[model samples]
Target chain A: MTGSLTLRAGLLSCILLTAFLVVWHLATRGAGVAVEMDPEYAALMGATATQGVSAMPGPLEVGATLWRHLRDPFYVNGTNDMGVGIQIAYSIARVGIGYLLAVAVAVPVGFLIGMSPLMSRALDPFIQVMKPISPLAWMPLALYTIKDSGLSAIFVIFICSLWPMLVNTAFGVASVRKEWLNVARTLEVGPLRRAFLVILPAAAPTILTGMRISIGIAWLVIVAAEMLVGGTGIGYFVWNEWNNLSITNVITAILVIGVIGMILDQMLARLARLVTFPE
Target chain B: MTTPRFISMEGIARRYPAPGGGRTTIFEDLWLPVQRGEFVCVIGHSGCGKTTVLNILAGLDSPSEGTVIVDGQAISGPSLDRAVIFQGHALLPWRSVLGNVTFAVRSRWPDKPREWVEAQARRFIALVGLAGAERKRPAELSGGMKQRVGIARALSIEPKILLMDEPFSALDALTRGTLQDEVRRICLDTGQTTFMITHDVDEAMYLADRIVLMTNGPGACIAEIVENPLPRERDRTDLHRHPHYYTLRNHLLDFLVTRSRTFRDSPPPGYDRRHPPVVRPGAAPQPVPVPETGDTLPLAQFANRRHP
Candidate 1:
């Protein structure tokens, strides 16, 4: 039954894609109206000078541009003309470093807060005030203090990713089953061993859930951060293409951003599954 | 002969502050003792603080007013010397049956090699009749199987006292009976000191050498300690046919059904708080012989005839 359902769903997706392509082709197809103008002026008009073609590129045009980008994805023609792969690679690296730094700081702090009610209460007000502010809101301060736009962008990703993970780890560690803690106590397991053996395993699934959330938010914030900082990232590629009025390149960058975001989310999803246990 | 007290609770009282002003006493001025290698069960209704007493003995909880001395040392907190079998089984769901048992074994003997820990855990698992289920997680095991894992884990620790709080109360009747039999056999063979709390009178009779009965609470106390009259080798199937079975069963039933509620208001004359009276209900002036054939006398009539 599931196999048949999957086949039908695939068929429907094919039909939808075909319909969308057909509509796009028809809309962008230029009317053949011959305008009586001087040869020099007509040459300056570029695609508009053709008998009846619209200036807007159709799906066919976008597909050709996407094919060219894929063919030479890592070409570095100049500072502003790097290939799509290089741009995406730069974005991914920034997100990776920022997210790892967040995990290093958040998890241990989260553990301290979760394990102690006094710490949880004391830090709660600070976390509440800091959590809801946008990562972009910190851009001016980050740029001024760090004096490096690239590092500031990475710092934004870190700040955006930290709260979900910290909150989740704290909540998970705090709510570990009382009976399991009692078992450790009765066994006379020392505090450090008990944390690793009993509390860690018991709270693992929750901690992973928090990490998954943080990774997704980090990926999302990295794009906007890169656009603001404007060095070498998929988000900057889209903005640069828009400035050049290359609509096809802008559309291609959007598609690449979506695919990479999905892959990043899927990676974290698999990690979450690895830590989950049947209860 | 005076038996040396392997464990003793001196003037233990557990109380919680009431909602408005004063404290609510769950139980107060309670004293009890267990000789080495003895099986004792505390029987009482809900709210009687039977579990509190057991927790105090296990060093998992502190009494508001007294100390629990085990092997001549006052216990301040949980120790490796006492192992508890929780009512919920409380097996770490992520751990396999052998893993759960080995965790305790490793905790008790951190210097032991991996193979030695595995061997020790395997022995206890096999003893609990869970030999073939060593790799199964708690989620994969049945309720009875999970509880067997709990038993194996507790036993592998080699505690000086095994503290159980209604360990079999969650199982079905058949499973409870089988586990009880397993427990009785293991305790008898090893002469392990055990203190258990249960509401099941039949379970108390089948396993305990002495059953401690508590009156109902807000301030419960040890009402009496009744010595089990049946031989240690008594069979569960024919337990009813034993000469003093009905007398002992009815005495426990009467206390739970009626006396536990009123014992607090009207204390028995000259009842000592520190040394609760030990009663042998079936030991009347005239001895009753073991029934040879099918004796069909009703339980109430049999109890009255012997005790009266």
Candidate 2:
């Protein structure tokens, strides 16, 4: 039954994709009536002015461009021109570094807050105040202080990724079953061992959930951060493509960004499943 | 006469600040002592603070106004000498049965080699009849099986005292009976000093050498300690066939149903907090002094048949 359901879902997806492509093909098939115009002006007027083709690239055009990029994804020609793979790699690198740094800082701090009521109460106000602010809101301050666009983008990813992990870790740790804690106490497990063996394992699934959320937010924020900083990354690639009037590349970058985000989310999801217990 | 008891709770009291003001005393001036190998059960209704008493004994909790001396030394915190089997069967769900037991064994003896630790764990797993299920996680196991892992984990530590907080209360009747039998057998064989809290009268009768009865709270206290008259070797199947079975059963039931409530208003003629009266129901018949007599009067008459 599950297999048939999956097969039906796949078949529906294919039908949707086919219908979308056919509509796109039909919409972009016609051109405006040929109009008398000077050659030089016609060249500058572009397709929208000289012809009736939609400004939106047809499915075929986007697919061809996608195929080309995939074929040679990692090539680099100049400062302004690089392969699609290179752009994605840059975005991933920034997100990875920032996200990892956030993990290193947030998890320990979260544990402290979770384990100690004093720290939890003391840190709660600061966290509450900072958590809702947009990641891009920090871009100006980061760029001003860091004086480096790439590093500023990384800092924004770090900030955006911090809260979900920190809050989840703290909540998970604080709410660990009292019975389990009591078990640890009766066993006379020491502070360090108890934290590592009991508390860490118990809170791991929650912590991983936080990580998944952080990675998603980090992926989203990195794009906007890159656009603002105007350097490397898929966000810059999209903006650069837009400036060059290449909607195909922009669409391609969007698709790639989505796929990467899903992959990152799934990676953390798998990790979460690994740590989850039946009880 | 001068020798310290195996486990002595001296003047222990538990209180929490009341909502409006002052304090609500759950129990006060509680005192009890156990011999080296005795199995003791504390029986009380909900809100009677029986589990709190067990927690204090385990050193997972502290009494407001007293100390617990275990084996000639004061216990300030949870010690390896005491292990608790939590009511929820608090096995680390992430760990397999073996891993759970090994965790406790390793904690109890950190310097022991890995093989030695595992061997000790496996031995206890076998003792609890969970040897083949060592690789199974707590979630993969049935309720009874999960509790078996809990038992294995607690026993693997080989503590000086085994503390249980209604460990079998969560299981079905058949499972509870079987687990009770297993626990009874293990305790008897090892002579491991055990203290448990339960509301089940039969459980107290079957396992406890002496059952400590508590009155209802905001100020609960040990009303009496009933000594078990049945031989320790008695079987669970034909337990009722024993001569003293109904006498013991009826006495506990009577105390729980009626005497537990009114005992606080008017304790017997001579009641002591430090040393609650120890009664043996089957031994003799003794009338307890009551200020008011009615239908509830006869139950109290046979219930506290003090043996001293």
Candidate 3:
């Protein structure tokens, strides 16, 4: 039953793709009459004016552009013209460093909050207030304080990634089953050892789930943050393509962003699976 | 009497603040002594604070009022000398069977080498009949197997006293029976002093040397301590056929079903809180009339009836 369902689903996806492509092809088949004009004038008028073509690129045009980008994904053709791979790599690296920094800070602090009622209650107001503000809202403050545009982009990722993980780690640690804690208590396991041995393992799956959520948010925020603090990233690439009126390139960047985000989410999903227990 | 009681509870009471204001007592003025190598089970209805008494003995919780002295030292908190087997088989899900046992062994003897810890853990795991399943995580194991790991982990610590809170209550009947037998055999072989809280009267009878009964709570007391009349070598399959089996079973059942509630409101006349009466139901000397406060019979009357 499952196999047949999967087969039908795959067939439906292909049908949908074909239908979408057919619609795109028909929609962008420009109907305006061609006005014979000077070659230099036509060049100045851009590709859209050549034979009165529509400015919007069709699926075929987008597909060709995607193939070209794939061919030399990591090419470095000066500041404004680096390959898609390089731009994606820049975004990933920023998210990676920022997310790791968040992990380092959030986990221990979260442990403290989870383990102690005092800290949890004490910091709850700050977390509650800070968590809802958009990471992009912090972009101006980050640029002013940090001074580096690249670092500012990373700061947004860090801020965006921090809360879910911190909240999750705290919830996970605090809710560890009383029986397990009692088992450790009766064994006379010291506080530090008990934290590492009992609480850490028990809370790990929840912590990883928090991490997964944070990474997804971080990935989403990095794109917009990169567009704001434009140096070199997938988000910047999309904005740059839009400026150049290269609709095909922008669409390609969108696809790449989606794929990379999925990969990032999948990596954390695998890590979550590793720590999750059957019970 | 010179060698201090192996374990002693002196006027221990547990209370929680009520929603309105005043405290609600779970149990109060509780006093009991456990000699070395004794297997004692506390049997009571759900609300009678039987677990509270066991938790106090394990030092997992503080008594609102009294002190628990184990092997001479007054317990302020949990100690390495006491190990608990929890009802939920609280094995660390991430750890394997061997890993769970080794974790306890290492906690008890922090100075021991890794190999020594593993060896000690393996010995206890084997003792619980889980020798070949060492690498299996708690999730992969059956309920009975998980509980066996719990028992193995408790015994691995080699504590002065074992505290079990319905350790086999989660298992099926057959599994519980087998685990009970295994626990009894291990406890007997090691001469381990244990305090367990259970609702199963038959389980208490099969495993406990003395069954401590608590009246129903909100303000509970030790109703009486019933000495197990069956021999140490009693078997589960033929346990019912023992001459004193039904008498002892009926006594515990009667207390749980009827007496536990009534006894809390109206304790026997001349009932001493400091020294609750110990009765060996099938072996009571005679039908002694209820006595007034000063006319109470000495504990020696029932003490002489117990088998060595």
- Give interface RMSD (Å), model 2: 0.9
- Name the best candidate (by lDDT): 1
Residue B303 of model 3 has an lDDT of: 33
Docking class of 1: medium
- Residue pairs that clash (backbone atoms under 3 angstroms), model 3: none
Q: Given candidate 2, what's the lDDT at residue B184? A: 94
Give the lowest summed-lDDT range of ten residues in model 1 chain B.
Answer: B294-303
DockQ of each: 0.69, 0.76, 0.73
Clashes of each: 2, 1, 0
- Give lDDT tens digits, candidate 2, residues B228-292: 99998979889999999999999999999999999999998878786677788888845333234
The runs of at least 3 residues in candidate 2 whose Cα sits more than 4 Å from the true structure, single-residue gaps closed, are A1-3, A31-51, B2-4, B285-308
Q: Report the Cα lDDT for residue A8, model 1.
A: 91
Which residue segments of model 3 deviate by more than 4 Å? A1-3, A31-52, B2-4, B285-308
lDDT (Cα, tens digit) per residue for candidate 1, span B185-281: 9999999999999999999999999999999998999988888889888899999999999999999999999999999889788777766778887
lDDT of 1 by residue, A121-232 (tens): 9999999999999999999999999999999998999999999999999999999999999999999999999989898888888988888888888888887888899979
Which residue runs does candidate 1 get wrong by more than 4 Å?
Answer: A1-8, A31-56, B285-308
Write the residue-wise lDDT of candidate 2 on A1-279 in tens digits: 556988999999999999988988889864765576897888888767777778888888889999999999999899789999999999999999999999999999999999999999999999999999998999989989999989999999999999999999999999998988988888778899989999999999999989999999999988888888886889999999999999988998998999999999998988888889888
